[model samples]
Target: MAKSPFRWIGRLTKPVLIACVIGFFSAFGLADRIAGFSANLGEKDRMVRWSAVLSGATRDAIPVTLIDIDPSTMAALGHPQSAPREVLAGLLSLAAAKHASGIFLDMDTSRPGSPAGDAALAAVLAAYPPDAPPLALARRLGAADQAGNTINALAEQASVLDAAVRGKPNVIWAASVSRIDEDRVVRRWQLSHTTCAPGPGATLPSPQLFAAAVASAHPRPLSDLNAFADSRTQTACAPGTAAASPPAWPRNPDQRAAIAFLIPDGPDLAAPQFITRDGRRVPLFRRMPARALMSASGAVVSPQAVADDLLRDRFVIIGASHAESLDGHLTPIGFLPGALIVANAVATAPAVLSGQPVGPLGATLIALALLGALVAITSRLRPLAAALAVAVAVLAALMALGRIFAPSTASDIVLAALGMVAFLSTIEGIHAIGKDWRARGWRALLKPEKPPAAQPTETIT
Candidate 1:
């Protein structure tokens, strides 16, 4: 007998119902909450860590260098709470002399230092040549008040240093902050921070971002960098000229980008190594001892040839790596120095600018497609086989998503996997209930068999 055309609709009813339910959850953000829970459990971090491991170290030459202030350097410099201003000035002078492309001093200069040291640092800043590479000094912001106003004590700088570079176009005060996740792992780098100030408001870019902005080969304007900041909020801080109060500092919702770690933390700093996926050795960033750059008298210690090769035309970041410095944070690979984190961020800057391989909408679509495909493929298998299929599909999706999108959309992949599992289980449950109902002849309550469709009785007496 010819089948009814409407039978196809009956066949599609269950799948359509499942799709609608999944779509509802996704649209209303329940899926996001599920993803958040997964992230809080470290699933997202694991995906990111594996992604970095599988992708391997960057092939291109690293354009950044770290001047590490390790224990030895700190002991040599008297282990002050802060790196001495004089020592920093000497390092700056050495880098400038070697034609470094840009320099970021990651040490906090929020308080006063010895008078002589301050004077020496100020002199170096004032004497910086017009043609010298741009300099970025780390500026720390005080805790925000109830109204979101922060106190940026200009006193954080040695009074002398502040005076020398107050209005210098080449000198920039950039924010040096990292976003530490709830698990205490530092996975993201906040690009810029805009806050209300007592005088004119201020905007500060992270050191990594500032380095990217002032890159010598292809310098980008400060305005260009704004595109990377949190687009949901106003990134521009208006001047407080009119006696009216400035707007409250907007919450930085999307200012941060996931850091793509190129090198894992090494146990041996003396002989650090990084091997890529293809078994090739690569350096993510060059590291040098701060002491190698200058002496107690602020005279260059390393030979000109060595210094030139190390510093010339490179973005240099000077930060402490000593254990006592308490500047280390947990990362995907392991506990690493904050300087290394900054270096990784600098390495990952290009990727951040390139953006996620797929955006939220695209990711959602991909996830839904993956779910639909999983459901279609697994429905025909035995229960155990179906479970295994689901597992394999979820694993494959996660790996691919992590490799292409990194941590930015890892949570979505996880959420999709979870939804698929729930969906399959619900389908199975419904089928089981239907089977039991028919076995017990309980289907009569819903819809009677209609006496076998009233089959004609052609039998004669």
Candidate 2:
């Protein structure tokens, strides 16, 4: 016997419908929105934390060290509102002498300080060896303009510090700004902050991002970074154009990258400590007080031998950790100081740049395939059994994803798959309900009246 066309259509309907639904959702970014909601609910954070715990801790020494200006260091510096430039000069010189691979000064240098202090800092920067490790000084972001676009020249320290590092090959300005999500949690880092420059058709890299690039193992030249940032924008103003108005920047979504936090923060903002596979507990990043690098007279206190032992071949970050510094940020692990955040960025820069091993398209395709298989298997089971099977499948998929990809990427894919599951389940439920209703209606129509209830007529007779 020949098969009916309806039989073939019925056989292909569910799978084709499933594929269309998944394709529509992926194309429109509804899946991404669902994943983002999962992140907002802290599911991504939990996955990251759990993944870190499961991955055997690194026994290799951490490559970064933090020179924190804690409460004690603040008190020693006479409780100044900001770390004094003169004091910072001493720390810079000490790190240089120790031959640190990179030095990131996380303090504000926007406004001019005491003439002597400014001179001292400028002198240190000028005297820094051209062949020595790069020094990145943090420049604070100024208030955005009325139009909400960041003005490049408005960086806090640009006016004063720009001249300090102008002729110096080793010193550069970097932005210390971090992107805060709607929930106010710091989860992502930008490679460069694209801002409009005062000159015609000029674009500048935000200092913090520049600093991060400098701090990486393979640093890019400033010109390259600027060019890269410029390429993302659509238009550049003509030279000699008035700075009053500039071209609108392009809405490039790739400006920011996810930060992979390797070290978790400790309680009360204490130095983070973690246990390694060897069963030994140790600090994640070696931390020393800023005062330890300076003498009571504010001279370089750490001898070259000690400095080399601690800072040599390591990225050194100088920033405040005191409560008054107001530099703390809420991270996936816990509250961490801004300096620590930068350190994490530097340490994990390579991974962040590489991004997920699987792209969105690949992940979606894989997820849809798995979903199809899951539905085919579950369709043969009772409703209760089907639910159990789905739950198990989800758990297994999450575990596999965690092992195969970074926490953020894994969370996104898994959450997206769950959305598809929910959507399919709802559709199937409605179909079943409709089928039952139709069956009941057909039976009612076919059912015959039982001789008009003959008993009532018999009673009358």
Q: lDDT for every model? A: 0.66, 0.64
Instruction: Locate the minimum summed-lDDT window of 10 residues in model 1.
Output: 245-254
- Listed per candidate, the RMSD to the true structure in angstroms reads 12.5, 13.7
Model 2 C-alpha lDDT per residue in residues 142-256, reported as the tens digit of each score: 7556324455334332546677688776676666567799999998776554345433333344433453455444555655554555553324333344433321221122345
lDDT assessment of candidate 1: 0.66
Q: In order, how many clashes per candidate?
A: 2, 6
> What is the clash count of model 1?
2
Tens digit of per-residue lDDT, candidate 1, span 159-241: 23577887676777778789998888898888777664554445677887677666523566544444444231243444332
Give per-residue lDDT, candidate 1, residue 346: 73
Q: Which portions of model 2 miss their true places by more than 4 Å?
A: 1-42, 51-62, 146-157, 200-227, 233-254, 267-284, 305-307, 356-407, 426-461
